[model samples]
Target: MDNNNQTLATNELATLPLGHNWYQKVASNFEIIQSYLNKLDTDEPEANNLKNKFDNMSDKLNIYETNIQAIVNILSDYDVPIAIVDGKVVEIKEGD
Candidate 1:
């Protein structure tokens, strides 16, 4: 490839965040919760109440996931290198 293309690719790579495991873990937990909720038989009164609670929880989780993704996208657009450091989102500098 030409030097220009190489530089562009490098810049893009530099902007990309280093960590995704945190997001993946959150997504996995959401999946697990949904899976368990799906297995419940909501015909019984107690089960129905529990199902309603789970449904609400699922909705909140979905909203949270959406917001997280939006933030990630915004950061990516601005070429910010974000990562989970000490249980917080931190910027990673080049060569650090």
Candidate 2:
């Protein structure tokens, strides 16, 4: 309802766990598909196409993982109340 309340709510939401588990599951699935593609006979043109698709998917997944890690790092820094702990800002309790 107020600025402090809004800030606290935002901080709480920001600290929620990112979907690392989901990303890992999708990545694992991609690995399985790629393995299957590799075992297939290379003479078939469709095999090549499927392998290429898997390669592109792997690359994009890597990029996504990196970006997610960066976001998590940034959020980890924000979770620490550095300004308040360092005495740069005082946190006033209600009724104080």
Top candidate (lDDT):
1
lDDT digits (tens) for residues 18-75 of candidate 2: 8535555455556666655565655578877889999999999989867766665565
The TM-score obtained by model 1 is: 0.42
Instruction: Return the TM-score for candidate 2, rounded to 2 decimals.
Output: 0.38
lDDT of each: 0.63, 0.56
Over 4 Å off, model 2: 1-43, 80-96
Per-candidate TM equals 0.42, 0.38
- Give the clashing pairs for model 2: none
RMSD of each: 27.9, 26.5
- Native-to-model Cα distance after best TM-score fit, residue 23 in candidate 1, in Å: 59
Off by over 4 Å in 1: 1-43, 83-96
Q: Ten consecutive residues with minimal summed lDDT in candidate 2?
A: 1-10
